[model samples]
Target: MSNPTVSRIELWHFGAPLPEPFWPSWIPGYPMTENRCTMIRIVDSDGVEGWSAGPELIRERRGLGDVVGLMLGQDATDIDLAQQRLREVGYFGWKNWWIEPAFWDMAGHRAGQPVWRLLGATEGGEVEAYASFGEVRSGSQRIADAEARYEEGFRTVKIRVHEDEDADIRQVTEVAAAVGDKLRIGVDANQAWRVSAFADAPQWDLDRAKRFADVCADIGIAWLEEPLPMDAYDDQAALNEYSRIPISGAELHTGGEPELRMMIERGCYSIYQPDAIFTGGIDQTRRIIAYCKEKGVTYTPHTWTNGVGFAVNLQLYTLSDRDKPLEFPLEQPSWIPECRDAMITEPFIARDGKVQIPEGPGLGVTVSQEALAQYGEQFFVADA
Candidate 1:
């Protein structure tokens, strides 16, 4: 049999309804009632399909299917070449890093192996999960939410913080005092990137971040995430130098591996959390993980997006050292698994705060055609 070639590329826009208004800590004041994404599907000549999703994307990729076909209509197994071509395509247009996962998915499917196994990882065991809440509630509400999660058997929980340092301190302090000894606590400042499009947000200065880091240290917070702006390398380095907690950022870095390497060299943060889909997809993420290991920095994936996005990052996470718990985005009633993972045939179920690595081919999850038909509206298709 000949090598399988990419025969077509398709794009769909989906808005999966939620049970209640979900609030994202990153985008303050905006009540999210639906999980939205632009889905990418690549088909091989043999009719095998591979899929991925870009979270919260609008019609920005409407005209890019033809561009993708023009650039990537070749052997489906040439992942490195496909990645390079996709990088080149992004030079003049948008950085379509989200589409790159489909290439890896296709390659793994053609090889009859899962992406993680293709990356040289032998096992597909469970990874420890950290409860990642995405709302900025009152101190009491936050404490209650965290306490509930702790009772549910989560060993670690991450809370969001913003605005006045004292108020932030109050929120974290209450939770830490309630369950710091029983749980590993992480505080996300949400200061790295602000969503000013919807409403104004608090921007943290170096001094503010330093003060908060000091507070986290006093409270025994395990990690401080995005306390300073992502590009605030010097400031973050300064804070990392003085702060007792591990400083983490780069979840939404646009510069890919090279920029991440530069940040690592500058000592921007002690922990590097790169979302594979947000970065340059799987291979680039592997590069970041390997580099972080070489530099002795902790690495964990940012898995706040939908199921497919989470799966893409999870595959990369399985290849990394399990030193830190993987991010498990869990906000009840609104951002539950049913809606957060609306497209997958089965939702990711975590028991005792641990999720088993998928053992299937490619990204290890199958997209449900019923869910796709119910929520997704296909707008672009291109045949090779």
Candidate 2:
């Protein structure tokens, strides 16, 4: 039988209405009213299909289907060639490794295995969940949210810290007090990749970062993330050696595996987080995992994009060390599970602070046509 070749590619611009405006902790006061992404679907000659999604501000990729289709129309089983072609396209046009995972989704389907098993996960079970609150709120509001998550069975939670050092200290103190010693707490500085779309963001130098790291140590934070800029390798390495708490970051780095490997060699962080969708796709992500294991560093994917993004990272997280809980983006009234997973057949929900790994072949997900009709607008479609 001939190897499966891609027959068609479809791209959709989908947006789900948010219950309330959401301000990302990183980008301080920008109120986001809807969750939007450019969804990618690839169908092979054998009729097997795979899907993935990438973040989008508007329908910017409406003209990309022709370029993407011409480049990715080769054999779907040849991941190496597909990656090479995608990278080549990047040299001239857009380099979206985000779309690369859809090919792996097809490969997994053809083999009748989940991506984790193909990536070498031996034991099969659910991964631990951590409530990752996206916005910076008041001490009382933060405490209430943490308490609600604790009641919801999440044993670990992460909160964001903006500019004011006093406010940051107060927020952590109140939440820690209410949740007690029962929950593990992590803090995200969001200094890794700063966005000033709405309001001016805080800029932290090494001295300020060290000061905050020292305060986090005093306040008993389990881990401190993105205290410095993402590219601050030397300072990050020094801080990792100096700080009492574990330092984590590098989720949105565009440097891919080479830079991550350098960070490992330089002892930049105690924990390494690289989103498979945002960074360099599955191959680079798998390489990063192997390097972390070899160098005795912790590895967990950053899953904050959308439901399809979360599912792609979840598959990779299942093969990780699981020393730290997987990040679950949850904020009430806005970034809830329903809105996050608006395109999928079923929204993923946690039970007792854990999520059952989808056992179906491939990424274990299917797009709901009803949801597509409601939220998706087909912007691009091409047949090979």
lDDT (tens digit, per residue) of candidate 2 on 1-384? 878888889999999889999988887778888899999899999998989998887777888787787754689888887778777767876568889899889989989998878888876678899999999988799888888999999999999998677888788888777774888899999998888777899878788888888887887789999999888899999999999999999898756788789999999999999998867888888899999999999999899998888988998897687889999999997999999998898888888889888888888888888988998999888887
Assess the local accuracy of residue 360 in candidate 1 as a C-alpha lDDT between 0 and 100. 87
lDDT, residue 22, candidate 2? 91
Residues 277-345 of candidate 1: C-alpha lDDT, one tens digit per residue: 877888888999999999999999999889999999999998777989999999987999989999999
Candidate 2, residue 364: Cα displacement in angstroms equals: 0.7
Clashing pairs in 2: none
lDDT of each: 0.87, 0.87
Candidate 2: residue 196 Cα off by (Å): 0.9
